[model samples]
Target: MDLCLKLGLLLVIYTAVNASDISVYIPQIAQKITTNVTDRSFVLVQPNCIFTQYPTTNVWVVVALNKSFSTISDSALSTPIPYSSYRNGLYNYYHTLLVSAGKYPCLPSDSTSNKVIQIGSETCKGNQFCNGVLSNNQTYRAKFILLNSSGIFDTTKWSNEIILQQGKSFQGNTGLPSGRSGGMIVLTSILSVLMAFLLLSVIAALIFGGRDLCWKRTMLNQKHSDRNMDFMPRSTYRSRYDNMYLVS
Candidate 1:
């Protein structure tokens, strides 16, 4: 009987330790990358998190612009209500809408889940629907709040400030420096012009050198022909007449 009791106690202790070991990790937001789709520019935002023991029921993510960390902390503390249940207040206080787990759909038992959110030039219309689009060459930050089905927020599990920026080329704003495509085009054009100029210079040099060599050869041939004419034999009659005069 005593052995049975000891074994049962050990089992309970092991279960408790295992359950405590399971913890939900804070979400990490990836750096924003700009991409062109159908002649339009867009920013891709991907945030990821992991669960060891517990299954994730819901996730609330938001992107705030031009706000400091202290301000975000204050707002987060002030609003104990989950974003799913309360949205109007969230829009008023925060910058953007909340993305829930239901919309994204991730397996709770999975070690990690990465969800993508796309921000386009038209996303921000300066209306109540969404916060205005992100500015070009401007820095922004994102926040992820995890919760359960009962709208209970895990204050301890939250993301740190994830910073990202948009390039000047985003959304047809060409005021900034050149992008990858533009820079390549400019460089290629310059190289092509230089190559053409070098080829022309080489061809001109060869043509002029050949002409100079031909002129020198023609002059040397003319001089040699004149010398041969001067050395030719005199008429035989003229030579005989001179010998007869000497004999007389």
Candidate 2:
């Protein structure tokens, strides 16, 4: 019994060690568990440029990632200057704008003029960029992201992280084998009842020896008769014999 209890405790410990541990996460934005990023889109538009209205001309689109505006050093902005009759510097002459809206003011362009612009060779945070430069009355897709590690843009990289809450665990219940009942609980209950019955039986056996079926010393004496033995005293038998002779 002691060995069986030790074995049961060891089995329980082994089961606990082998159990599955899970981690879960909740995002501020709507996201699913173990998901991949896909179908991401963003538009660049002049805030003041409404359907019927227009603003001062000469604006460009600039995209960036993981680079804060404040961290940018002044020496980094050493790109070739393009002379424009309308305006040279845009959005306070900031080359990299974090917002999707391009350097505002969608100005009209001629057919011969290149509607789409490109800063051919410029590096932002060591990443070479090739973005669409849209003119007035036109929209260009900025699908190509300047990833530092990889040459092309990938949602798999720029997508949000899956934050996980750790240490959640569970126990497994599987298909049971045949002819095996609940051993521990059943055996415990049976032991309790059997112990009670065994104690009562022991007490009765101590009080009543073997059984009533065996003959005792007093019972054997009652079964015998004293008439089967010699009944007279010796002296009295002799005197009776002598009187009988004298009379003859």
Candidate 3:
């Protein structure tokens, strides 16, 4: 009887623990990018997003359209990105959505399931050209709104908004005082000129100062030779009596 009771208690405890595990689902929405000047449509690039729960952390996986959608046609239904996190491990999934030129309103087909929403869009009001019976040529702004199911958790919950704009361009070697490759060349040339000047200065100093040193040494050697010549006895001397004095 005691063993059965213990077994029953263990079963109850396991169920309680699993019930407290947190599950989060987020829905994605996006605004189609359009411009008045050109009929090109674009979308914002996916960026890292963060989700925080007390003592629990999560990362976002972005999803978007696989192909460009037109203004006249409806967006094709695509798959949603599936991402999940239990604790330290990251479960990220990539999916795509279809967006067109006009404003798109979306809601999940299943309302009973708990989920959150994230909308992606751009900021520039670029114009799109439409060759239709009636021209709808106007600059349209992109907007994204995030929504969550009601009564999911007790923590503070609200929709988050993000706007996209024209990304900064890569200004290649332009608008600089020196050109891209020219800067290095100029620096190298300056260094070479300075080195050449230093070498020339050293050579000039050596030419003037070394001449004096060389001349003094040569004159000293010549004087020593003359003294040696004077001390030597002459081979043409007739006899010792002929020369009265000894030369040292």
Candidate 4:
């Protein structure tokens, strides 16, 4: 049982590493863990964040379903994807986006724009792009390809994983595979109950402690009043003693 558990943990770690590590494409890795993906109508880049491979001609971003750049099979990579014989092949493609110096320059570096990429199921406008469908609560990734009239000459490693959010359909940003179910609801309820107990304990302590202190102070004040009364003379017996002294 222990060996099985260890192997399970190791497998999870390996998949996570493969999913997020796009070192070559992104250079500096951001420390964010939230899902930064979309299934928007269009995927266009701003002037500063434009995807470019200068001195090369144009840039292509090939997207795949549940795949990293390194994991893509060599047979698929070696085969050109039909339209541009020079373009690199993608075995199981979902979407493609093209950026160029004419429309957008890839020169400027913008980390903020790095996380934004257009994704949808509809076909793109030109031969340079192919459309892919995105379902709710699915994870996807993309890689850059430097293309010219000949197709693709160079490419970058895969980008970080994107967990696409679909309106009310978005599950969460757990980054784990979909269709997982268990005792999550029960666990959350248990945690909430524990928190409530802690808060109540604090309140009860404050009220009870203050009540005891007030009772002690009230008793002390009453005792002092009673002692003062006890020491005072109730009546005087001076009349008889004075008369006897005068006669003597």
| Model 2 Cα shift for residue 167 (angstroms) | 15
Better of 2 and 3 by lDDT: 3
Q: Which window of ten consecutive residues has the lowest lDDT sum in model 4?
A: 82-91
What is the C-alpha local distance difference test score of each model? Answer: 0.48, 0.32, 0.33, 0.52
| Minimal lDDT window, size 10, model 3 | 127-136
* Candidate 2 residue-wise lDDT, 167-203, digit = tens: 2211114333333446866887899999999999998
Q: Which pairs clash (backbone N, Cα, C closer than 3 Å) in model 4?
A: 43-118, 86-151, 86-152, 87-151, 94-132
User: What is candidate 4's lDDT per residue for 125-229, written digit by digit as tens?
Assistant: 455445544555445565555556555555556656655556544333555334444467667779999999999999999999999999999999999988876
Q: For candidate 2, list the clashing residue pairs, or say none.
A: 24-165
Task: Give the least accurate 10-residue stretch of model 2, judged by summed lDDT.
Answer: 20-29
Best model per TM-score? 4
Please give, for residues 1-248, the per-residue lDDT of candidate 3 as tens digits: 99999999998886545333212222222233232122323233221121212212222223222221112111111222221220112312122232221212232444312222223222213311111111012222221222223211211111122222333332323664422456777888899999999999999999999999999999999999888777767763434435655542
Ranking by TM-score: 4, 1, 3, 2
The C-alpha stretches of model 4 lying farther than 4 A from their native spots are: 1-23, 27-56, 67-69, 73-75, 78-91, 106-117, 121-128, 149-151, 166-248
Candidate 3, residue 20: CA error in Å? 21
- Return the candidate ranking by lDDT, descending: 4, 1, 3, 2
Compute each candidate's TM-score over C-alphas: 0.35, 0.17, 0.24, 0.37
Candidate number achieving the greatest lDDT relative to the actual structure: 4
